[model samples]
Target: MKEEHMAKDKPASGIPPGSWPVPLGLPLYVTVEQAAKLAGIGRDRMYEYVNSRADPIPQMRVGRAKTLIRTSAIPDYLRRRETA
Candidate 1:
């Protein structure tokens, strides 16, 4: 394929390379803020959901003050909710 004719494969996020902390393809893991952005919600809302018993966005408690969410969670949820 000609260089100019070929499409440049990029992550779906549309975020420039190196700007995002995790890979948009299949992130190994993500932080609260990252998860929030991926989930299309605000950071405070993400925290609220995480803290709620009926947690909509699940996260793993790391030690005392840290939390980590499976990077694929958002994508899987989105896939499930995608319109047929």
Candidate 2:
């Protein structure tokens, strides 16, 4: 029974068994605050990351005040931050 036809199941893929595919069907853009929540970080911290010179999270300024981040950028940022 352990041997299967597929490569791996949901849990092995880091997805809960009954959970729906996420971020896959999510919007491409999200506000800075929303990005923070998605990344499990504080809004203030997200802004700090945005302002950091070392490795800032790339973001886009919509119009004058709205700041939006690309949905893929958050995970990409984390992947870059991964040391081990």
Q: lDDT, candidate 2, residue 20?
A: 43
lDDT of 2 by residue, 46-66 (tens): 898888899988788899999
lDDT of 1 by residue, 21-74 (tens): 457585767798988898897899767766766535556788899988877666
Off by over 4 Å in 2: 1-22, 82-84
lDDT of 2 at 74: 91
lDDT against true structure, model 1 = 0.70
Error of 2 at 9 (Å): 27
Candidate 1's displacement at residue 34, Å, is 0.9
Task: Score every model by TM-score.
Answer: 0.52, 0.64
Alpha-carbon shift of residue 21 in model 1 (angstroms)? 17
**lDDT per prediction?**
0.70, 0.80
